[model samples]
Target chain A: MCELMAMSANVPTDICFSFSGLMQRGGNTGPHKDGWGITFYEGKGCRSFKDPLPSAHSPIAQLVTDYPIKSETVICHIRQANSGNVSLVNTHPFIRPMWGKNWTYAHNGQLADFQSRLATKYHLPIGETDSEHAFCWILDQLLQRFDGDEPNSEDLFHYVIGLCKQINELGVFNLLLTDGDFLLVYCTNNLHWLTRRAPFGKASLIDAEMVVNFDQETTENDIVTVVATQPLTDDETWHKMQKGEGLLFCKGQLIYQSS
Target chain B: MCELMAMSANVPTDICFSFSGLMQRGGNTGPHKDGWGITFYEGKGCRSFKDPLPSAHSPIAQLVTDYPIKSETVICHIRQANSGNVSLVNTHPFIRPMWGKNWTYAHNGQLADFQSRLATKYHLPIGETDSEHAFCWILDQLLQRFDGDEPNSEDLFHYVIGLCKQINELGVFNLLLTDGDFLLVYCTNNLHWLTRRAPFGKASLIDAEMVVNFDQETTENDIVTVVATQPLTDDETWHKMQKGEGLLFCKGQLIYQSS
Candidate 1:
């Protein structure tokens, strides 16, 4: 399996420290290599980058460590070949537009016979991975249910959950999604999270030779949350998730849940 | 609730079309104007941008729209205040490092009476949101369990999942995490994904006034996956998750699962 990383902060914070460590795993510390990608949100805008090279040896990855771009929400991935070939087209983290919003998605699991069941009138896959094919299938179902119209939140949530159940039956379906308003995350295997509040302190990186003094970089009112496939530091404690749990994140905190 | 947007491709692919549509929801079509964030990963490097301003009116957002940065994995979030005050520090995505890799996180739910529960050895928070507190708490636990060492994959996975369950008891704990190798997602409420592969076609945005012709932008071997809080298009279907399900994504496809 590959790895995943995410962040939610109370202020515009840079991910240089954490990202540097993750880069090492692409081919150095761990064995993800295949490819890597990241996305940053700035105000109403977004800045993203991707490369087909192993993050551990990629020049692009170095730039990220040197830059200090800040954001409130972010998602990233490094690939380890599974169903698809080790090519640039088979990277993680995908994006689309739904209900007048740009919905982003990333997956880490296999769906048995996904292509056979996928059907969409408005969306189709551009790659060969079952992960992407599954995305198209879900979009097809949404269109069928809503009839090209935006449904209310309650209805939309129910519909998406129902669809998730069906897809899960085909295979694993852990996922993360957003449309610029709410963050929806679901786990079917392994995931972790860490939230910080007032009284920030010093923290060191577990992957690379780096460290950060939150006391110096943040204020007393800042609140930030970091999520990852594995704990990113040797000195930090990480929270894991149970199988078949879904929750939503809004405004730097969790708000809703279903299980 | 907030909104999230992500894309995982076989090769580096631009999220311009989907992002354009998602931008509308930051303040134009939705009320997630509290803040916005986006992270793009290229190889081992990442480029991210975020603002505490509404994405719809931010000049930075406009610039993002004009620039076509591409990546294999991307994560973005738009904010809507619920627990913490609307400040730049209270944005969606947060970052940290561990096990020689970078980790990014974003949440979409509110935890009741959530606060940092670290054992005083992990990094603390600078804000008051439960999200940040949770981040620190998780880090603290990981550090404690591993004895200041990065555990192996299986050990890390088991330990982290245990932590997630602990936090879930506090309230909702939906999350997205990445270390640039894989995308690990957990759902305790709402999360969805759609995968795309060969035989692609045009996809219209449900929130914005734009569309993308996948056939023109991708190859037959390309594989991509998208995760979202809600489907971003009006005519596409999105797969939803069960209350307790988690998945891992690697190489633009699913790899691990728990339900």
Candidate 2:
């Protein structure tokens, strides 16, 4: 199993405060130490940093925590390597171009017989990881359905939800996916989310001894939503998603949710 | 115009010495201050770091210079934007997945009437840059020529050379492209290459005050070749490539060249 974290914000915002807590769990407080990766989206372009080293002590991970890279959408993963070998190729938060937009995906749970369960066509897995194979499978499905042109947002959201449910049937398939504009999160087992808006307050980390007052760091109109496999803060209230549920967020606000 | 840098090595080697000099040219030594990016290949997986900020002052660039990430192949670019805006989407060293391999590209010159010259079908440019349009055009052509399976390396090399010649006709199109295993360099006007094998000696950077003794850093069996728009070092004797010429290098050895 792995740990996944994603963020969507109305304005370009940094995930340093939440990432600090997650970084501690990569090796210091938890066992997810195989590797780690993160992607930040600014407009149509997205940049990713991945290391085949423990996030808790990786120099690049430390740089990420110290540097505040502002982005509208962000995705991160810390791997424990359940299926694939521990290498740079197996690091999570995989990205591929689809419909002229770079789509990023990360998984937090393991799937049983993933290769046989998912049949990919247009997009193929570059890395020999079950998670990457599943991501490519999902992209291939979307490419088949939509072709080059994008479908309506609502229709695409429902289509993706159906795909998520089918993958959830295979096994524990918690997912975080985004294409720089919209962030779609699907929960089969463990996932939690929190939204901070105008009435933001101070928050303390659950894994690390760090605290940040949102009032001092954010403007009143700013809206930021963070999703993770587990709650990173102890003070902030996090809503746990039910199993087999899917949610879509755009510009930090929830746009769709599966009942 | 931008500055392009690429490396092909028989073994995993760090480009910290050359990258240090290139970092200075991003804003301090030269005028390529718009943005910068670099991709390092580790097996089938490749990780890239890009910033819209100037490389000279970018903290991410500082981390790249400080951290010695070893890779068999690397493609880097520092942009002095002419055809696109100074944003992350338009940053150089664009990447796309084709034939289940991550193909990375960086260009150093502008193309006139690129949109008309290149007609893309399968892949499209997400960023509004002539460079990216040209990259997608190249990929689309490859996809059309070959299906999912990879073609013969020699045939693919010749095909790519022909494509480079066609793009070079539009304008200056000095380029560096790679598919993790092979590095391809195309020169229209300014490009230089240097290969260091056994009996390695000291090399000094031209843009920065840095000296490295390959004798201490590399093994006797190591073969490393570096390609750049200009000679990155003052001490090493770099070979200047001829106009409308394309070279294919695999494992630091020249495998094919266009007459």
TM-score of chain A of each: 0.91, 0.98
The model with the greatest TM-score is 2
What would the per-residue lDDT of candidate 1 be over residues B1-259, giving only the tens digit for each residue? 7887777777887777778888889999998898887877666445566677899987657756776787777878888878787765567676544443446677777787575333333344544567766776776677667754667555665566667667777777777766566776777887888888889887888887787888888899988888887788766677887776777776578876777
Off by over 4 Å in 2: none
True contacts kept of each: 0.08, 0.89
Best of the candidates, lDDT: 2
Error of 1 at B130 (Å): 40
* TM-score of every candidate relative to the true structure: 0.51, 0.99
Question: lDDT of each structure?
Answer: 0.72, 0.92
Score residue A123 of candidate 1 by CA lDDT: 59
Residue A234 deviation, candidate 2, in Å?
Answer: 0.8
lDDT of 2 by residue, A5-35 (tens): 9999999999999899998888989899999
Query: What is the RMSD of candidate 2?
Result: 0.9
